[model samples]
Target: MMLKDKMRQLGRRDFLRYSAAGAGALMAPGLVRPARAETAGLTMHTWSAAVDTVQSHLSAFTAETGIPVNYGNSPWAQYREGMVAKFVGGAPLDAMWVSDSWLPEWAEAGWIAPVDEFDSLMKYNAEAEDFCTQSMTYGGRQYGLTYYTDYMAFLYDEAKLKEAGFDAPPSSWDELVEQSRVMKEKGIAEYPMMLAMAQESWLIEFISTLVYSHGGRLVDDSGSAVMQDSKEGAVEALQWVVDAVDKHKIVSPACVETGELAGLKSFAAGNHAFAMVAKYRLRMLNDPAQSQIAGNVKQAMMPQGANGSHATVGWMRFHGMSTQAAQDKARAENTAKLIEWFGGKSDGAYTFQKLLFLDIGAGFGVKPLFEDPEIRAAYDSYGDVNMIQAQQALARKKDTITPWFGEWNDTNGSAWQSAILGNVDAAGAVKKSADLWNELKDSY
Candidate 1:
């Protein structure tokens, strides 16, 4: 039976439940109590599993400082928008997770506070702190803190490849095209890939990876938008998205409807062959209770460009304070302390890394944890490749992202989506994306 057939194979559990292990821990009442009754609770914005991981470590903050933290999370694809909406509406936000690419715009707009403003905050090791920080700083004021870091790699089922008569995974985009065609012809996959296209920014993650993999620059040093009309490899990257749907038909028709979560679930359900793997995805892929493909899928280095080179995005999901923090110095101080606890070498964040990274065979940005014996053992699958790839990717990551990333995607990514859906031709889509992106760049 086909992998898609297995999702409805009757005896198998529902595909919706395939990745349930990644769900956030229950937000229990009184998980944290303020040391003083008068202390105001802080509202933090984050994504679901990430929030659960943080929630697990938050008791230390509550017990020591008496700061009560209330968690608010949106779907990962919509998180930046949710943060922006909160900031725009003047809603209460003490500290929240913001991506590196989105930080500059927020900081420029005065939507977030500098982490340096907090007193008694924990200090980060120079190395670990750098994983996601290079993109978040603006005007010399530090505005973000990252506890866990990751990268974009490939995840595939060795078993599925064997079923399709392959012994090794594709190492280049050209090979990926052929391999995916074979998988479809062999009935091993109905859709050769589960491409993310529904959410604009989420779609950009996949596109940016392809751009980098093809040795293309998505932007320049000044953080300007450069991909649309450039002779850079980005054109080939965007063209591939169009071809994936229109010509090769290697991607699912549902690409226009799938977001990250659904794409991940379909992969876990054994319906798709390749996925753009992030650090935390190791958890979902290996959780037997949550993955039919558990133990069968593993991380592979990202495929190289047509030119035998590649580029990549860096991991930096930083917790940033809101401008509203200035309203109450005492509460802001308390919130700062919590954020400090996150970046510190102390046990709260270390514990978070152990669960989110080490235990799940994922990687993090913390320098100290890399020395731990157990942590190294947990990541034995990827070996030293992660360290090497990560550093190189870090150096190039800034070129592909800007503070206006969220806005640029809305303009450009939507056009790419139109191309995928056959509503517009590839050249028309690329032109539209460029024009819209340039407009956003000039305005913001």
Candidate 2:
């Protein structure tokens, strides 16, 4: 059945439920404490990626500032849904994690308030990557301080490339296809390119990376949908994936069912010669204990398309103040201090950002952290620092981030998946996606 038809049959709510289920393997929701009394110091919420590290930092913040924190987290898959529930139920919240894509929606709903008045937080913009600062801003006002930021990156097994008689990674998508074919024919690998195209939270990032690298924009500068344009649009990008699966057979048909975490495990098992993944995964990919292909994995610029540069999509999560917390003068002040502590500096250092990078290989927004010997040495251990910096220089923020993003991403992802699965052509898929985008924009 067609994607739109299937979604209609299942209903939008059921489709989202199904999509959420696909990410369940990554993590289960953790217990979130009920909203604390107003007399309590502060309350914070985050997705369950770096719980231990965040708790440790929170502990230190409390020790130094005498501000007790009630911290909690849910799995990333359910984070947005859970946060919305909390907002509607009037749950007490002070500071919380917010994705860049959710900024317009949350701000418009009055769930999150601007932090532009906090000079302590604003001062760090001078030292942050432009992408980080820009992502944290919405509609002329800055909403939060960056918790973490990273771009999608193309990666490959250097050992596999060499074994396939190639000296370096592909610079273009066509070259990648040629390399994958040789690897498959030589029995070096089967389905040599790993892509997680599943309709989950990670789906939009993956799609955006492809679209941007292919020199296409889902939405133009004037905030209009252009993804269906015959030239320089999302069709060119989606067509590449469809061709990769159906024509070249370099990527598995099962990719539509694979989420990012599962694809990571598959690549780490040395089952694929090339993959597109989050830049931070390099740390896990090169860890001998976690990855069988350790020390062989290498980062490369995202392969370009015919009219494209090597650009890829970048995203950020920030520490945002809850509207409830911002209404109270003292609470807002304390929350800003907490935000500065975690997102900017802690005890005269980029402590949390540095710790986050060192702990899980997550990227930081702070540019000065790149110069730190400790951080430099750590990147050298698992990756090429020069290559990492070069690729980051090419990172671009997703253009489709708007108030209607959450609703449109669902349709866009499903449409792309349909094309990949051969249920629709690339033109049909992108047309469907662009149509919805335009409808959403008009309504907004």
Candidate 3:
């Protein structure tokens, strides 16, 4: 059966039981190597993204290093559960892609091994974005190198703003409401703001961006839930969103049903004057072939809240080594090379990062990449180089990531959505989220 079906059969409780049992077995001494040929080299796995580009890169790695590789991929939605099954089942694996949210759980579960001893890999941290390095590190040990990273960004339809007689995007949240009201009154747009508030994976990132930009946090450094504090940024930030949707009527009620991709499509179609979306979408929005608002789409700093700065939330996925691969010295060496080849330097430069960015508009974690003339030129074509760099410098990682994040996030997303729908007050929504966060943390 497929991994998803297996997960369904096992259920969440059973899946945790399975992972717990697997953890015990993984921790035992004398791990047997998979029954692959000694000369077969490495087995790499990834989600089915940029397949042609990844295959081309893999072919180049083999041609240059003379290392045979067996690469395979599954759909992204199924990848996490599939990887867990593989980890528990001891499938042949060397390097694989890992999302940041899974780091704590995977690390604690012994599914992935840290690469702190590898100086070649460690050297990249000096050049990487702080959060990318931080996100890869868990329990004080760095796991692997970053595959890609991006931040949520505030974007606007320039033509719509201009038609509404605005010279520039709003600098503050209140200003945004004022400008949106003007755009609405002018008939530039019925719903002048676009916010995808659906209960999905993207919801947390959206929530974090709003909270961070408003100078609020869901949790503090002690890992205690502070989202319930009205003095903190959460309540105010959420209240702004609530007012925007109900009182201002600037954001469509349909936002509760919108997913990130759908919101991107709507923004690209020029149906909304302003939007909060992933920074990478700017490339797609500016592509004439894909977007109706191409050339008229522009990026702006995340609007500030009364007490917040222009901070936004950032996230990353990385190439991590399997505990199975790390157990053997030779295999560990080869696995690190493969990871470094893709995540670090390939052919004496950040060839893969550049290629990935040029091919699909993905962001890189390395600081030097921003200085590359070609990368600069490409970004300049679709965005302001200064603004892009400026906003990225202000990005922070999500504060709620923990071993229990997956369980808590579902409740958190639902709580925020309830508030947005006016089913609960903002304070009540935050309290509900905070309660679950504290409960989960205490259990941990």
Candidate 4:
């Protein structure tokens, strides 16, 4: 059945029910009073999961320091715009959820407090250090704290590939194209891979990975726009997608209308042999109730570029304290204690284990979680695929962890989407994106 047809059969209540079931796995015990309310009047702005996670660990924090959390839960979209408005209006929150992409804008606006001031608040492991330093720092000052990190990688259906006579996965971009072609020819799958190109977020994912894989940098040291508009490497990388849809015909037709969630669903349903997905999709693929290819699903690092670089896009969400919030040294200390109790080594390990069991995706920022025997064992069952992906990501020479400007989402994102949709040639699309980026750069 067409994905669109399947989606039309799904009612809104069905999606809500699915979400409820998913959340049930992570739901915490009801809120209980701390022994002492050290931070009696502090409020925080974040998404619902953070609130739940924080609440789950509140008891430990209370035992350490009595800080009653006045937690606020808002959707990510609202948090960014609403928090900015509140901060600009002089009604800043004590702390809020901040993603890596928002760092430049928020840091430049001076709305967030320096993380160094909260040194005693939390501690990060070495794995966190290996992630990305620029994510939390700006102007030589740390402005945010990260609890989780996410990246885009390829998820594959191991059983389906074996059926197609492949004992191993593709190692390079050329190999991916060749294998995808063979997968289609053998009737192994309608489309071997599902690429998320419908929404702006997915478009960014596609472009960021392609650019990085091809030894292309989106911005220079001084934050100037720098993409190759007429390079063979860039053209070759872009052509891979063009051929996937237009030539090899290995991508679903619904790709134009499918969003991130829908693409994940298509892959989980065993309609595609592989998918370009966020770390979180691991969970969906493991849920026997939701996935047809349960044990068959495995993850692999993205294919290498012509230059032999293994580049993938890293996306992270961070936490930041508000500058306008009244500073209560005692309350801040208690909040820090709470963050540490939930996001520190022990909690991070727990989160990683849960993620592995649920296959929801990879843990956000903590790398040490991989060292856990159970975690490593779970991934090992998939035949070292996860390890290879991680190693490739680590081996990549450059990382595009710079803060994205507002115009980036509005302009560059749109142009990339246009190219993916076949509305513009690759060179034309990149040149347009570069021009828009330069314009945004000058305005800043």
- Winning model by lDDT: 3
Q: Estimate each model's TM-score.
A: 0.76, 0.89, 0.91, 0.80
**Candidate 1 per-residue lDDT over residues 254-346, each given as its tens digit:** 887888778888898999888875645766676788999888877666777775365566656676788877557877776777676775544
Candidate 1 has what TM-score?
0.76
| Per-model lDDT | 0.69, 0.91, 0.92, 0.65
Better of 1 and 3 by lDDT: 3
Candidate 3 lowest-lDDT run of ten: 30-39
Could you give candidate 3's per-residue lDDT for residues 1-444 as a string of tens digits?
A: 899987678778887898998997888766544556554889999999888989999999899888888999999999999999999898889999999999999999999999989998999999999999988988899999989999999999999888989899998999999999999899889998999998889999999999998999989988899999997899998999899999999999898899999999998888899999999999999999999999988899999998899999999999999998999999999899999999999878998888999999999999999999999999999999889999999999888888999999999888988999999999999999999999988998
Off by over 4 Å in 4: 1-39, 121-127, 229-235, 325-335, 345-362, 377-404
**CA RMSD for every model?**
13.5, 12.3, 8.7, 12.6
Pitting candidate 3 against candidate 4, the one with the higher lDDT is 3
How far out, in Å, is residue 218 in model 4? 1.6
Q: Write the per-residue lDDT of candidate 2 for residues 1-444, one digit (tens) a residue.
A: 899977579977887897897677445555334547444899999999889999999999999999999999999889999999999999889999999989989999999999999998899999988888888878889999989999999999999999999998999988999999999999998899999999888998999888888888788877898889968647988988999999999999999999999999999999999999999999999999999999999999999998888999899999999999899999999999999999989989999999999887889888888889999999999999888888887888888889999889999998999999889999999899889998998999
> Clashes per prediction?
2, 0, 1, 9
What would you estimate as the lDDT of candidate 2?
A: 0.91
- lDDT for 205 in candidate 2 is 90
